[model samples]
Target: MNFDLTEERQMLQDTLRRYLRDKYTTSVRNEIIDSDTGLSDSIWAELAELGVLGALFTEEQGGFGGAGFDIAVVFEELGRAGVVEPVLDSVLMGGRLLAAAGKSDMVEEVIAGALHLAVAHGEPGGRYDLDHVHTQADGDTLTGRKAVVMNAEAADHLIVSARDGDAIGLYLVAQGAPGLTIQGYPLLAGGRAAEVTLDKTPATPLGLTLADYEAVNTLALVAISAEALGAMETATALTKDYLMTRKQFGRPIGTFQALAHRMSDLLIELEQVRSAVINAAGNLEAHDRDLHLSATKNLIGRAGRLVAEEAIQMHGGIAMTQEYELAHIAKRIIMADHRFGDTDYHLERFIALSAA
Candidate 1:
């Protein structure tokens, strides 16, 4: 199948790239990360106005695009820019779940970027099991802990997952509802996550009970894998530029045959990642979507590690410094392995799916 982007997608990509290139400067990003909220309201509003948030949903959900490529196109740009916005947590994951549950009206503020939410589904030992929820739902109250809730600190509402009479269900818990606690901190990458606790917190049922969980998880995997692909591309380009500019023995290190060969290997790895991402995106709605998603994530985790490690080593000490862009990009690529499922996790998952 052809991989060429459609004209609309191409325009969206170009527009997002230009916007980030001009506004998402290193200093500006640093400030945003260092801000009290750990996010920039102004930039968030700008992205909304530019129709970035609207692209992740469909017309039924008040968005223009909700396909795999739409999610991939938007996330890849965010990854390229190393944006710290909560688009993934809010629009892609939480918002989509809300829409699927017939709570599309609730997401209007989110689509407008005036609100943010997080899916508090992961538990301390869930280990990538989407339905392994220990959160107990007793009538209208929830009680349990959710670990690594991305964007939780800034969330206006949390899409919480709990066991509803032996079936996993989602609840909408307001941020400051009684007995709710959020301990937020920055992640190894640029953004923040929170360890959330709920003690009989009042919640509203969203009318979903993990029935469409695979679709949600697969969609997230597809989006994040695309994001990792973008990070790898950036890391590769940055390393290549450094090799050409940094001189060694009165010659550019990239001119050395051995180093050139290594760069060639990196290029090959990048192409492999790109192909895997494309395959996953294309097969997002297929009958064997789980197999394709697991395979894509497996390749991404492994390739991301190689790209991150090689980029750092090639750049040497400077790459380890926090101020450098390569360091952040590398961190994102490596940390991406921990999200959804790691290399080994996905490998096992793919095998199990294949066997079935």
Candidate 2:
């Protein structure tokens, strides 16, 4: 039960950490977020060249690695840097879905960072249910609305989920397809999301049926849980540093027994989240993957909320300001809970899975 990363993964971790540390500062990220597309083509290309994108898929999928650990490693780094790119949406979720559907051409473009893709699976009032799809597909035409479609505006293609008869199916919709409209806006954290409107839009079927859709959705949960762990680590470290440095009543606030105790609790929660993420990642391909994923996401949602609250409270007003790094990380943790499934949602799911 060793948690140590393999040499290749460790190297990938180091390389990605260095690249993001040098290039993804708050100011640079701000510029990217403020831009028309809210993305950096140069940085995206750099990530592709560094094999960050390739690491999320296997050789069979037109890349080098596609294991659960690979996805966890890449996304953890992305979370650490608070990167606003659509790598999670495009690579982890959409690219993997394409790979599973045997869409080698699109997966290759994704690995090469030549194109962006997003999954438009969520809809208004869906309430975190992956199969609660209202979008309908008939004869290669899709008609429905998808809510919070991350990176849709910047995507070259969208892997949209739709109801085909009684089963869920995935389709590929090209950018600016007829009768397709995207209303893009910034997320509370850093990236952009769109409300996608499809009015009998033409689409290409991806050959993925209901079972594949469920599997991909569950994998997405594990990926984001790992990402949330990275963000919580950053937030916790930032809070601890602030406590150790910020003077209060002629001494550092960290010297106070009350604050020190609180910090210790945060560290314990962080460790718990780390363990949950590891467990979920390891069991991602197992038969009972849904059980592990639900449990992991539930723990992540709860622990992430605790970390976000404690970090913000410890930092006072500074952590709430957008100009600081912890604020964004905190936002990421808080918002990640809402994505995939929140604490209550996963908790209920875990209970049902356990009972069955």
Candidate 3:
């Protein structure tokens, strides 16, 4: 099978890579991470202007490219640059959910970067179950707590999941709605998330169901796995460069057979992750997408941890310093496993799906 990117995808990849390389340096990223908001408004706006946000949707949804490959191309670049923007929260999760709910207006705003949105589905102790929703909606009001809501502090509106009778429903709650409270905190991977509290908060019910959330959640899994691949790419590259340059006992440490073997192992692991991501991305619309996605995420979780740890160890103390690129890259790689689901979670899911 042909694995090469099409002309459009290749162009998109090249354009995004060049733009990020020129603008998103390690120093600039560090400042963004240290900032109170944990993101850059100017950079976010620029990315929108460059059509990065639009790439994640389809022409029917007011975007030119919404295919699986499009998401892979965009997020991989973002991860490689260690961008701290809330693209994953604002565009992939919130924007896609809005699109699924037929909320074209809100999706348009999201694509234009005029409105930021966060998905408030994860409740305390829910772990990674998409069907596990404890937040209840009584009429047009919601009362529940959402845990670790990414980009909640910056969101103009939140897409919250709530129990409505026997079904899980999606609700749109405006920021600062009555009885709504958001306690924002910086994430380890250079973005802001919040623990959101709602007490009889007014909300607008969306025309979406549990299935919609599950589909979007699966897409999110594919997106982040691709992001992990990009991060691993950067981390391993950084480690390879360090090994070749940093000398030990009058010779480059990488010249040692032991270190060379270790680096080769990392490269092999990275390629394995790359293959898994590709498989997941290609099968996004397949009937057996869950199996591939679960398998991909499981591999990413294990391989990402391996890549992050090995990269840091090979680089020594300097790799842990915040100023170094690998420090943040390593953090991004490790933290990615926790999103959607971790290694063990996906592994079990894959096994269950396979058995059925």
| TM, every model | 0.98, 0.97, 0.98
lDDT of each: 0.89, 0.89, 0.91
Question: What lDDT does model 1 reach?
Answer: 0.89
Clashes of each: 0, 1, 0
Candidate 3 lDDT tens digits, 179-250 = 899999989999899999999999999978888888888879888988889999999999999999999899
State the displacement of the C-alpha of residue 217, model 1, in Å, after optimal TM-score superposition. Answer: 1.2
Per-residue lDDT tens digits for candidate 2, residues 170-205, read: 999999999999999987787789999999999999
Per-residue lDDT, model 3, residue 269, is 100
On the 0 to 100 scale, the lDDT of residue 308 in model 3 is 94
Candidate 3 positional error at 243, Å: 0.9
Q: State the lDDT at 257 in candidate 3.
A: 99
Report how far residue 224 has shifted in candidate 2, in Å: 0.6
Residue-wise C-alpha lDDT for candidate 1, range 109-145, written one tens digit per residue: 8789888888999999888888789999999999999
Range of the 10 consecutive residues with the lowest summed lDDT in candidate 1: 206-215
Candidate 2 steric clashes? 1
Clashing residue pairs in candidate 1 are none
